[model samples]
Target: MNSLLIALVRALRSHCWLRLLGCAFILSSLGNGLTQVMVFGQLLRWNASPGTLTFAYMLATLPGFIGSVWGERLCRKMSPLRILILTEVFGMVALVFPLYGLLSHHIPALLVIQSAEALFSGMSYPALTLLFKRGLSAEELPAATAMETLIFSAQVLLGTGAGVLLFNVVSPLCILLLDALSFAASAILLLTTRKKFRVRDAQTMAADFPAHLPLHWKHYSPLQKRSILLLPALAAVGSPAMALLPALVQQIRPEETTGLALPLLFARSLGQLFGPLLLSADKLRQFSTSNRRILLCLVLFLGGYFLLSPLSAWPAVSLALIFSAHLASNVVFALGTFGVLQNFTSRQVATASALAWRGQVMVAGLATGAAGLLAESIGATGALYSISLASLTGVVILLWRYRT
Candidate 1:
């Protein structure tokens, strides 16, 4: 018992700061999620008009579009830690930037605020990715991913609970204030880590920046180039699900929208947990290599979607099935994502991650925006079915080319 306790203590102390920042990053991210849900879910309360909420959501996505173009420049010169601290500080500013809308009743100001938040978030993901790479080894990446999913799981669980509890208890600005404080805490932690690492690099802003006259697209190997090209497509699929799901639920059962939709959200997180465990338990690899496992996971995931769509009456059951399928899709998606990512990059992880995230955000923003609008018109469930079917079909096409 004493030995077991000591071992547990040792494990807990393993790479303390990296783990800490990773955890804090999630907490702040959760706060962001809370703010977004509270605001978007109750858009009518914010003195909003029809389709304005949807527009706001899209505005929040614009940063990624711009982020991909410039993110790599910053990552190349700055430590991931520094990049995180800077982007998040800016993110806090972004979160608060919209208060003027409520204060003066200016719609355009609020739109700008949402855009800033998305922009800062776009800048932060690459830094986070770099930290994840630095924080874990090849063997530990799966566990690192588990921890990540767990943090996101808590975001949904905790943030939703808080958003609900505070709906009448506090103002949205109050929630935003708390997000700011979390950012401050995260920045402090990052500063401490920076001092500890004392990483001194010569990379300068000007050197890494896209040149004024012309941008130099770095030469990439065939596989690497293919991976970069594929990034936008893969991200497009992953980005749209959350924004669209609730709208879909509303279409089916407006009365039970939150209850039906939130649980489905939980199910995706739950599925993510289960999907990773399957890999952690060695089940995913029971078939073959990482590549093989990824393909199998995708194939099964698509099948899960087929099973999901046909269940007409049991919306609850259907939600669970569909989310679970998505969960498998996410796992393989992450596996394929990171597996390809780690292998694909010739540059430092930070720069590569920045480029990749930029691609993701660019594609994800468009996909999510489109999905949200489509959900309002087509019935959320049907839209999901079409997306699932179409996405799977596209994958089959890509895989055929992959074989050749």
Candidate 2:
């Protein structure tokens, strides 16, 4: 743990531009954490049904597909720093509609504005990945990525807790205002890194991307191929369970509702922040390569889901279980992503990052839509159980085949 921290510190200290970018990321993540809590809280307050939440989530995420298509091309054409600035500027503008919605109590317009923001997010994310790939050396990637994930996750943890506290005491308009300010702040921070970034022409980009890159699917060893194929599916399985959380709280803890929702969200974010740290330990690093770690984390997730299914009504127990489940899931996700970022060529990184991101968004949107319908048909608890059980069975089959 000390070693990993030392490495992270060294990397950040050595790269002034990266340090600036990290600070910017921190501000953005803090705003994002608050936005998640505020948006859902407002929707529930406005008497939004499960179906409405589902549609909103779907609309918000699915638009990323279009944005990603544009983003892939933009990342190639423009300097990533330039793209990041534009996205943040647009994002700040996009928040205006939500701010207006809060002031005017216009639900439809709020939903539309929120969905529109996803487009900028989609474009910006790939550009962000390109920046890291171009800026850092290959040796610096794993630690840098780990540090980035931890920072975002930690900020999210603080953000959600703060959001909950502020929600109880303040107006939604205040929270939205802060969220907009975060975007503007992040953009200003990004602008300072201009000297470190330059637009690479087509010849330079092609020279960076080798024709016979090992990132191709057919080029991977058997185990690596299986891991790559299963990563997306593993990630997708947890989405529906997460989508059900707000409604589950409403169902099992009607008295507490939004009060409990924020804490549960906080627990999950806490898990995400710490999970990679666990795997970064020297002893755990051995397990990281053999697939044992991934399998164990998957089991942990399944076990937590099963237990939480029956006990979602108990606030304390549910918080712990949700934390453990998400922690395990994040570990698995981080491991797979680390492998990709470490191995991928600079040119391949943007495309792979965009595709992986787009896949997650589409799947989460669809899964949320499905979960909403299932919750309406059965109870939330039943929906949680059915979805998790199916996930476990699928993972088990996948692992069993990989073992052979």
Candidate 3:
């Protein structure tokens, strides 16, 4: 742990630009965390049925799919720093609609605003990945990614807790305002740090001339293709379980749903924050390949889901299971997937990251929609049991195919 901490400090101290970018990311995460709690709580307050809320969430991802389709071309045309700054500017503007909706007490307006936010937010991801690929050395990439993930987890943890407390005491509108200000602050940080970013390699810049979006399946090995395709399915596995959280909370403690939900979220985020630290430990890394690590995480996720399905009557136990599943799955799934992605050339990174993210969003949307319907038909526990079974099946298939 000390060695890992030392390496992280060295990386940050050596890379001034990384420090600036990390600060921006921290601010952005704070905004996102605040908005997430506010939006979901508002949806419940507006009496959006579970099915309706899930469907709205599904619809919100549609624009993200569209954004990913064009993200590659956008990255090809603009410097990543420029793209980053521009997206932040657009996101702040997009937040205005939701703020207006909150003021007017209009549900439809809020939904529309949420969808717009998803679109612009989705567009920024590829640009951010490209920046990391361009700016960091190979040795620095893993630690940098780990650091970013850690920061995000911390922000989510702190922000969710704070958002909930503030919302309870103040108003959701205040939370929304804070979110917008955070975005503005992040943009200002980015603009101020622009000069520190490395120049794009001239040769790589020249290669961007191909007008079409640049996915060439022929270039990837079969294993790589399988990994990419399965990533979305892996992501979809947890959607049902997560989608049922509000309903589950209501069942456990009807009046305290809002009060309890954020803490549960904080638990999961806390797990995610610590999960990557395990990766940095030489003892763990030396014992397993990335694929093996991912498989183990999947098993843990499946176990958690199955356990939670039957233990819904026990909120404390269910929360513990949720935290464990979240911790393991995030490290194995998200970070492990990115580890594979790093193997690709800079030219392919944007396309691969965008496509992979789009696939996850699309599948997660479908899963959430289906989960909502299932919850309506069966109880939330039954829906969760079904999701766990499906996930177990996926894990079995993955294991057989990889045979690692």
Candidate 4:
């Protein structure tokens, strides 16, 4: 942990742009965490069915397909900084719908908020990723990513816990308002940083403002293509957990459905917080070269979910499983995302990032939609088990096919 902190401090101190973007990312992630809890918590309060909860998640993410295409065009024509600022601002405005939804107890308002936020998020992802690729050195990238995950998880931990506490004490409208404020805060920070970034690299900015044309898919090596798919595949498999959580809670702890949502999220975030820290240590570098280690973590990641279906009936045991599952997942996520980003060249990064994100959101959206339907038909536990088993089989085939 000390080493990780020192590394983060070093990275932030050395890079003015990173410092600004890091802060902005933190605020955005916090808002996301809080939003998850608040949205689901209110839905549970209304005695929403599993299908409804999962459908909400599906609507929130599926629009990213369009947004990614839109963002790609924007990145080709506009500055990344401008793209980010606009997306954040629009995202902030979109939250008002959710706030009204909470106030009026209207489901469509919530649905609108989900679709709008997802679109803006899709638009922002490429810009955010391109900036990181352009600004940081190769040596700095992994550390920065680790630090990013750590900060994201930590803030999410805080936000989820706070959401639970705030849910009881404050009105839902107030929670949504705070989330809007976070978006505003993040946008303002990005706006200020835009000037700093320009001053530091005016020439580079002018030369690279509108990125060059993307390389054709045929241009990428087989390994590079596989690397791009890995994260999205993992995400598709794991994405059902959040959408299914409300139902799982209501299933196992029917009397305490509202009470358990945040705790599960908190546990997952806590594991995510530690995963990067643990992996960042020097001792872990040996395993970094071994495909066997990747497979091992995959087992933990998928196996945790497989077990979660049956064990979710026990609250304490379920929390522990959630922690372990996400811990393994964080390792896979970091490795997989970095692998995709690193495979592309500077000119290709924007397109690659956009495509990668598009794949993730699209797959995850579909997976969540499937979970909703399955849950509606067979119940949440059956849905969970079915998804987990299918995911486990799919992953095995993927790894085997791609094995060197």
Model 3 misplaced regions, further than 4 Å: 1-7, 59-62, 151-155, 198-204, 207-214, 281-292, 309-316, 402-404
Estimate the overall C-alpha local distance difference test score of candidate 2: 0.71
lDDT leaderboard ranking: 4, 2, 3, 1
Task: Please give the clash total of every predicted structure, in order.
Answer: 1, 0, 0, 0
TM-score ranking from best candidate downward: 4, 3, 2, 1
Where is model 1 more than 4 Å wrong at Cα? 1-12, 44-57, 101-114, 132-140, 143-157, 199-219, 222-231, 281-319, 344-346, 372-379
For candidate 2, list the clashing residue pairs, or say none. none
Worst 10 residues of 2 by lDDT: 280-289
Superior candidate under lDDT, 2 versus 4: 4
lDDT string, candidate 4, 25-112, tens digits: 6787677667777887888889988888889878878888789888877876767888989987887778878877877889878778
> What are the RMSDs of all candidates, in order?
5.5, 3.2, 3.0, 2.6
Index of the highest-lDDT prediction: 4
Per-residue lDDT of 358 in model 3: 83
lDDT of 1 by residue, 113-167 (tens): 6677667766766656655665455644445445544554555555655665665
Which 10-residue window of candidate 1 scores lowest in summed lDDT?
281-290
TM-score of each: 0.76, 0.88, 0.88, 0.91
